[model samples]
Target: MTHKRKIFAGMSAIAAASLVLTGCGGGGGGDVDADGNVVIELAQWWEPELPDGALRGLMDQFEEQNPGIKVELLSGPYASTREQLVTGAASGTMPDVVGLDGAWVNDFAKQGAIADLSALMTEHDYDDSQLASQVEVDGSTYMVPAVNFVYPLYTNDALLADAGVDAPPSNRTEFADAARAITEAGDAAGTAMPLSLETPSGVQNQVMSWLWASGGSMLKDGKPDLTNDGVTETIEYFDDLYQDGVFAPGAFTMKEQDMVEEFTNGRVGMMVDSLAHLTMIRESNPDLKFSISALPAEDGYDGKRGIPYASWGLGVSESSDHKEEAWKLFEFLMSEDANAELASMAKAFPGNVASVPDFVEDDELMSQAFDIYQAGYPANEFTGLPVAE
Candidate 1:
């Protein structure tokens, strides 16, 4: 797909100067230092999840290869990053390079907040075929997924055993029953539900996942279809759980991190969570026993299940003055070796079609998650929608 990048590239020097003067910190000044080095900002939520300084080490490697370019990492939690990036986009002061969520792609592209990646690819003669599916807006690419993380049901083995549940739930009925059993047996809630409307990703990552588990969708022919039978039933099912007091307390204000924390502390019996959090949970509570499984499906459907996923999507900002240098960092991260290393560190799958995460072969839990991913189709309807966040 061909699209013009002139609109982004043609931003005037005066406007660039204004953005530099008023922008938030973290390499917000896209300028060459006195030492003749170009400093480009890399903003995202990935670094905190990585081994301390691991992502920085990778950037050091990139700096070595590209002598005149330097990268400044601006890392934070997802919610904070989203807020900062949104404000930057609004004021024409976004960082040089950003880690994107597919959900934010369409809105950013529509507002001319991110560069047209399709044009960049064509200009650089990059091989798009090696990458997994991308996020496009209005027929032009804007974001490249660097790695993929799937959400799976994480059950506290000890809690389940204590509750007298024999196995992980494989269907809706069994899941609900197990959750209730856990609740009745002890102080722990049956499931951790993060429904914070402030962050709102709970809707995308948790609630929508239930419908997907049963091969359902919120979109019909690329439009809102929330009134469908699948959605109606999914809502009712969750409502019943709510009435039964099986959902964790503070769900209305809980975030994904809170959900993971609850599961890690044995406060919840089960949750559907990102595989990327495996390292954190293990590091936080070494003795907590848990098992990963595909989310419970609607009973006896027997078709290929729909797996929910999110990506560490990469993009260059339209407001960046160091676009060329930003593109270099983006390219390095997407390279096969780099992509594989990142996926392994995150306990996720590589976005490069030819890259494979090495951890899956050694980690039993990761192996199980990979198998679940293989058996199901990736199902996320918000990937390229406006106001999806």
Candidate 2:
């Protein structure tokens, strides 16, 4: 059978297991009590392995605030979390609230598994602009953006200075020159871009950023435009960068963490990564002097500097019977203070635009990151492409 079919089969098994567990009164599907206390299961992928506890803590706080509601956090590995959610939706056993990546919103929305949060926002007087465009589709909100991270060039300032470079590159040409200088210094690998073919996430991330920087998008009016000059140019740039020995020997096999670790260990002078790396850098090396700046632009392209904003949002499952309570939980999470607190706890940037100013005031790297985010463009969404299954 096809890979998708196999995934579906595995998901079906998981759903069946969940049903059996629920029937035995060993899971989160128990009925509500007379005290108005409702047990709501929240399916999420932020397990201990992920290291982000803000979401969990937020849920705990919600439970405390609303004594009548109890939220059960269901954590799972990232590999099967999405599949489980899809299966839950299909089987009408989805959790009350779910933490999902913005990219997955389109797919779930298309499947009619997510509720229309626009009405809730309107009723609550919530400002939609606080959320990113990706979470808002066709004038109806489907999710509450929790945290956002912008992709930027991470530079080791001390290493650059040791190599006689005063600052990070501002444009593509300057970056190329600096990479050569660092490589010639003979201290370590000069510059590394994630050129790993094995890790499609890295490849896609880099390509999408370059594509945006080159004044091109993945889809123009909802159709793939592979023949677009911008797309071709970006791909060719990666091929050339690979052939030039700028990347590590097995960069094609390098994952995101691997690349970040290399830069953190001083094995690389510069690396491109998400802004969320700020806290990791601080924790990994307290003395490390690194700076985050916008990715360099193509030589002559005058378009906005592009930084991919990676984020997750909270959404109520349409299969849920407690959407009102779920919305209350969602509203609490999206509140300014709540978002700020979670962002600080998670060591991540906030999704609420208003919270950006607060984040900037406290974290310098986040300040620069906010600048990049404001100057960046949104991720491209195509209409005709089949959503990932």
Candidate 3:
């Protein structure tokens, strides 16, 4: 902090200063601006619906708080964010500050692209439990969460009533009963799970939640252990679900988006989905009675019930010359106000826990996520599993 501040000297006391703005118009750039401010290019896949200038507002506030630093946003759709990040690192054109998907954290670290944030975590007092587990590998940390995703179970109350399930299922045995009962009542499939290796990641998400809730894990000997008892039981149980028509036969080929479509169309009685759809649920089914809950666990499993977590994190590039400034921007972005603003629009878990209580739209999901932010394992059991595999 001491040495980095000397890198920029201002024009006296600044007579009504003007902030410089370079949007995501073209490529990335991390240079000294004409105004003597350090330009830090920030690349993220912030949704377009976030008040149009939510990120811009953050940048403006950061500039106002700390003079002589300008953050340029290189925003794009989520579909291309990962590709853009990978290509940028490969071509030596990466932004000074970039947002990455939770899954990319380990890969980026292996490629030597992102700086380790261990020291920063210590300096900033960031608890590992409060942060997403995906950003940390071995004994080092690579990224700090930008926004974390909160996944919750969505249950159709009408279907449950029709099936005579007065309360939500808390364990796998009851879960099966509920699924079968709902399906047998002629409403639709009992539950919708994305099981298709067509999108391998989606398969991991679908399976891992069930496994974790059953107190199983992916890494038995530092690799995916498909032979784990819980994993095997989950596979068998899901097979039963498919065979009994509790889950659609196409569950083996359905993607996450497909689940979303079917659930929204009132074809599924229960499903696990992101908090992002809080608004979409009301829009899709105005009369549907639904409730949210944590995923079910095994009847006799004594271990903790874990859920899937997806994170978007902020990290400085490994080769960047502005590590200190980059860390500053990272801190600013993760501040409570900034975190809440982004989370309010993103409809996901906020990076800062202080912002959790303010959320009310999907309060159960947000509150649950906040309480257990330091909890849960990955949705993917294995690493580097290609889609075709």
Report RMSD (Å) for each prediction in the order shown: 7.3, 4.1, 9.7
Global lDDT of each model?
Answer: 0.86, 0.69, 0.69
Q: State candidate 3's TM-score.
A: 0.83
In candidate 1, what are the lDDT values of residues 61-180, reduced to their tens digit? 999999999888878888667766776787777899999999888888988999999999999999998886688776788988888888999999999999999999999999999999
| Model 2: worst 10 consecutive residues (lDDT sum) | 380-389
Query: Which residue ranges in model 1 land beyond 4 Å of their true spot?
Result: 1-41, 63-95, 122-129, 162-164, 184-188, 249-258, 265-267, 302-304, 319-325
Top lDDT model = 1
How well is each residue in 280-377 modelled by candidate 2, as lDDT tens digits? 87899888888888777788767776566566568887877777777777877777777777666655666666564355777777777777777775
- Runs in model 2 deviating more than 4 A are 1-12, 19-31, 47-57, 60-70, 118-126, 136-141, 213-215, 282-287, 300-303, 356-363, 374-389
lDDT of 3 at 205: 63
Q: Give the distance in Å from residue 1's predicted Cα in candidate 1 to where it truly belongs.
A: 42
Order by lDDT, highest first:
1, 2, 3
* Model 3: lDDT of residue 347: 65
